[model samples]
Target: MTAPTPGTDGPSIRPRTAQHYSVAPVLDTPEGYVAPGMPGVPVTGYDPGTPTPHRRKPRRRTGLALLLAPLAALLAGLAYGCAPLRAADSLGWLTIAQAGLVSLPLGLLGGRNRLLPPLGALLSAGALLLGQLIQQLRLVHADTTTPRTLLQHTLTSWRADLRPLDLAFYAIALTGGFLLTRRTATRT
Candidate 1:
């Protein structure tokens, strides 16, 4: 084999394959780099271009709460008025405690409305007053005393008949109802 001529092919020499590389686009801004057109993806910092999340409006339940409040107050009042009659005289404190506890639900249920607190308190007071009236009437009927004398005695001695602790219990129930309702209404 003599030396090949310049035009004649001897051993074929192949060229090396070219290498390829790629990189993501980088942006320099105060809000940091954010890919455009991607929804709900938060940028590193504050990006004015980014879409804000949608916020749903709170549901309005004030009307429904107002309607239910009086009914709840009535139930609470009935509970307070009847509890003492059902229990023995020695356990009067138990009745007071029950009345206070029972009234809590009324506050919790109706306190959502602005007017419910006062309404609940008024209903509770009325119930207690009615109970006293009924008790005095019963006493007058049982005794041989005249209605006028019994009424006068009951009215004059009403303060003595009502213990301070019982009043405190009623106050606590009313205040507790108002506070609880107010707190819940603000949160909504």
Candidate 2:
């Protein structure tokens, strides 16, 4: 600081040197007051209630999952049919891939836990079971049979044709789809 300087009327003060401080952003202030901003600090436009351009609006996934579940299950069924049913080692990666892939959209589009996992599992089980029945009818009997009779026959004989890892693969697919497809809970 400079000493006081003499003026015509009275002693006048000399200008003091500017003070230096480290640059830091100030967030807290008195009500209705905004603190001084520091240089080189970028400001954000995000507000509590305002929607961001990058954030997609949260939506219900049930409708889309319901629509696509059947299709995905059908594909899995077709793939299952192609595998050697007698000594099948695995359900084939395609079935597992389809199940997991179908679940991705459910996770990405929706928020929080819902019925999607169980619903997908149910659809998949039904299609796979029905596929087994149809395949047995086409290959084993090759005779004209009523739907009810065919279903009953498959029900009785399905256990006989069960492969070593059939249940395990099915379980893996279902579990993978469920766990891998879980959605995050949205606050807004």
Candidate 3:
């Protein structure tokens, strides 16, 4: 049906009928939208159910306590190893990988306990050290023993690559892990 325009002299606006519409309307939702007074539904003064209050669903944590620490540590180590592959510069990249990807996420996901934060920090640091070991292993190209030639090269590379700044980054990552883990876990 057509209705007159309110203010201006213009063509009247027409309300759309079902025949004029091309698209099909949604009939039902996943929750099965039901109308009041339908069959078994209460017919007494139709009342729309109060909308549920919006709230963030609490994230599901890994159930096993025994597996949590080792898994976080291993994942942290693997994530650290991946950092070198992503960027040419190892300094800041490794720091971000350890603190951002590994420590922060793993710590938040790890069990909430007073002792867990310190443990997560230590584990993350240990894992990064293991990552350093992985780097040293990568330098050893030959699978078989190289009669001390390759071994010396590996050790030298490891020693030369480690700098005072890298040590500082390591400390930062450990502190970040402890702080982040402790902060989130303590909250309700």
Candidate 4:
């Protein structure tokens, strides 16, 4: 079969039967080649199911959110900068290390990637637990109290400190969720 001429909607495939030769060569598509409901599918018959030619839509990205990722990372870095790492005690340094570790996930998630959020959550939670331990250690060192009393003081301190930091995580999670949802809605 001879190919159709470029640009004209014509049949490029030749029909086996002699009857189709009289028609012009322009009907290349099923819709164009075969007339609707024709018997034996005339070489000229156009198929209805072929997709229409179209340009693809462009990809969308979260420009603003992506931009904010660095800022979030900086904030986490600042938290580390503020920590009392130079203190003589090992536990004090541990508290700072934990805070820094927890902040890393937040910084990572802020950037363009998938693993950051889960890692951030894991690190943050771990850091919080370690921070509690540091607080308990400090309490134990400061007081002449029994083990139970030291544990109680640590728990109390954790309750006060942990909630705000945990709340920040919730906020980051919510913000990221909202941004993704908004992008999807716009795409559809």
TM-score of each: 0.46, 0.53, 0.51, 0.28
True-structure Cα RMSD, model 3:
13.1
Q: What is every candidate's alpha-carbon RMSD to the true fold?
A: 12.9, 9.3, 13.1, 17.0
Q: lDDT score, residue 61, model 3?
A: 61
Candidate 3 deviant stretches above 4 angstroms? 1-66, 82-88, 100-112, 143-156
- Candidate 2 lDDT, tens digit per residue, 1-78? 565566765666666567566976665777765444866545687577986579765677656656666776676676
Candidate 3 local lDDT, 1-188, one digit each (tens):
45667556675566644454477776656675567657765467545786766877456363443356566667767655555543524544365455444444444655465666676577667777766656665656555377576667766777888888778777976886677666655244
Flag regions of model 2 displaced more than 4 Å: 1-58, 82-87, 90-94, 141-148, 183-188
What's the lDDT for residue 106 in model 1?
Answer: 44
**Local distance difference test, each candidate:** 0.54, 0.60, 0.61, 0.47
Regions of candidate 1 where Cα sits further than 4 Å from its true position:
1-51, 84-120, 127-160
Report the C-alpha lDDT of model 4 over 28-134, residue by residue, as the tens digit.
57554655568765555468799889877544444543454344434544453344635423332333344344434334334434544444444434443444456
TM-score for predicted model 3 compared with the true structure? 0.51
Whole-model alpha-carbon lDDT for candidate 4: 0.47
lDDT of the structure predicted as candidate 2: 0.60
Better of 1 and 3 by TM-score: 3
